[model samples]
Target: MAECPVIEADELEKRLGNSIIVDCRYSLSDPEYGLRAYLSGHIPGAHFLDLEKDLSGPKGRHGGRHPLPPPEQFREVIERIGGTESSEYVAYDDDLTGASRFWFLCRYFGIRNVRVLNGGWEKWVREGRPVSTEVPSARRGHFQPHPAAGMVVDINWVRRMGRGYVLVDSRQRERYLGVHEAIDPKAGHIPGAVNIPYTAVTSGRGTLRPKEELEGVYRGLGGRPVVYCGSGVTACVNVLAMKLVGLDPLLYSGSWSDWVSYEDSPVATGEE
Candidate 1:
C-alpha cells in the first residue's frame, strides 16, 4: 500500500511526460498474451514488461513458478524503463495483478518513487484515454538496485517461522481450502496460514479500496503478516494491502507451489 500509493488515470495522464509508465499486462494462462496486447495498443509512451521474461527468474526444481528476477536482469528492466532513483514510475496492467507485482518489485529493490496506476488499463481505456501502437524506448537510467534485506523469505524461513508471525494465504478460499486446485501439483495451504484472498484488497473496478475498507479486510491481524499465493504472484496484492494499512509485510516468494515441491511439507485442508 508506498502504503501502495496509486495514480489515477487522470493524474497519470497529466504526469505521463514526467513519469516512467510501463505496460505490464500479462496472462498466466497464455504466455504470449501480454506481449500481443501491448502490440495491439498501450498507454502512450509506455514500455512493455513481460511477466515471465522480465519479472520472474528461471524455474527449476523449486523456487515457485515466478521467483524474483535476477538482480542484473531486473536492473536492466529498471534502466530500460528509465527508472532513476528520483523519477516517478507508474505501472498498469489489465487485471491489476501485474501492476501490484511491478509495484512490489520496485519497493523490494529500494525504488521508493513507484506506484501502480489506479483501476489499471481497463479504467484508462474505458475513459477514452490516449492509447498508442507505437512503442517508445526510454533513455537508459543510472538506477542501481538496493535490495531490502529480509523483505523476501525462503522455504526454510517459513518452515520455522512458528506462530509468532501471521501467515496469510493470499489465494481464493477454495484454493486455500484445497477444494479447487489448478496450477500447483498439491492442493491446500501452509499450516497455520489464515486465508485472506488477494481480491479483498481491491474494488470491483480493479482499483484499491479505501484505507478504511482495507483496514477492515485485515482487522484483528496483529503480528507481522507474511503473505503468499500460488507461485507468489497474487501475493503482492495482499502485501500491498498490508502496506496500505500501515503494516510492513514480508513476502513468501516461494508461496504454495514451492511448499508442495517438498514431499514432507505439511499441508492443511479446509477452514481451521
Candidate 2:
C-alpha cells in the first residue's frame, strides 16, 4: 500500500531546509495579496506558485478559473520551480484552494513524492516557522507525470459510467440540491451523482480527517467514486481527500458547467 498525500507541520518541519515547500495561496478577488505575503515572508525555503499564472492557463469556454496546465507546460513549470523526480514536495495555501490545485496537478502529472500541508500556511505562520523575504532562484529538474489510469474523465467518458464509474458531486449541499446558485450558472448536479461537498471532506478548521473516518464516509456510498465539481479544479480536493482515506477516485474534468452547457444532458434537483 502507498502512503497518503497529506503531511503534518511537525513532520514537515523536520524536513525543512532539505525539501521543497510550495506556497499555493492566491485570491481571485485580490490576487496580489498572496504575492505580497510571499515577498513579506514565507516558509524559509518555500516557493510561491500563482494559481492563475502558473497552475492554470487562460480560461476558455471549455475550462473554468483553474484548468490544468498543459502537461509539457506544467512539467517545465514544476521543474523550473525546483521540483525534481526525487523531490518530496510539501504544498500549502492559507486556504486549501491553491494548495489543493497544486496537489491535484502533481498527482495528475505523476509526481509521486508530494504531500499537502494539513492546515496550510495559516498554521505554518502560527507555529512561528522561519520566514524568508528573498525570492527563490529555481533549479530546473525532471518531472515525469504518471497519471493514475482513468483518473480523468471527460463528458463523453462520463456518458459511459453505467458501465461502472461512480460520479460524486463535490459542490455544497444547497447547490447540489438546486436551492442555491452562485458560482456556476447551473444549479443542479449530474443525474445519478451523489453529493459529498468538497468542504465536508475536511474539518471545519480545514484539515483532513483521519483515514478511518474518511473510509467510513466514502464506503457508506458502496462504490468506487468519481469526483466532480462545477469545473474540474475543486474536485481535486475531494480526490486528494479520498486518496488520504485509501480510495482512488476518477475526476470529471468537465463537471456541472460542462454538463449544463449541453442541451441534451439530464439534470436533477431536490435533496434525496
Highest lDDT against the true fold, candidate: 1
Scored by lDDT, model 2 comes in at 0.78
User: TM per model?
Assistant: 0.96, 0.91
Worst 10 residues of 2 by lDDT: 58-67
Which runs in model 2 stand beyond 4 Å of their true positions? 144-149
Number of backbone-clashing residue pairs for each candidate, in the order shown: 3, 2
Per-model CA lDDT versus the true structure: 0.86, 0.78
Pairs that collide in candidate 1 are: 1-4, 1-244, 2-5
**Model 1 score (lDDT):** 0.86
Model 2 steric clash pairs: 109-145, 110-146
- The parts of candidate 1 lying over 4 Å away from their true place are 1-4
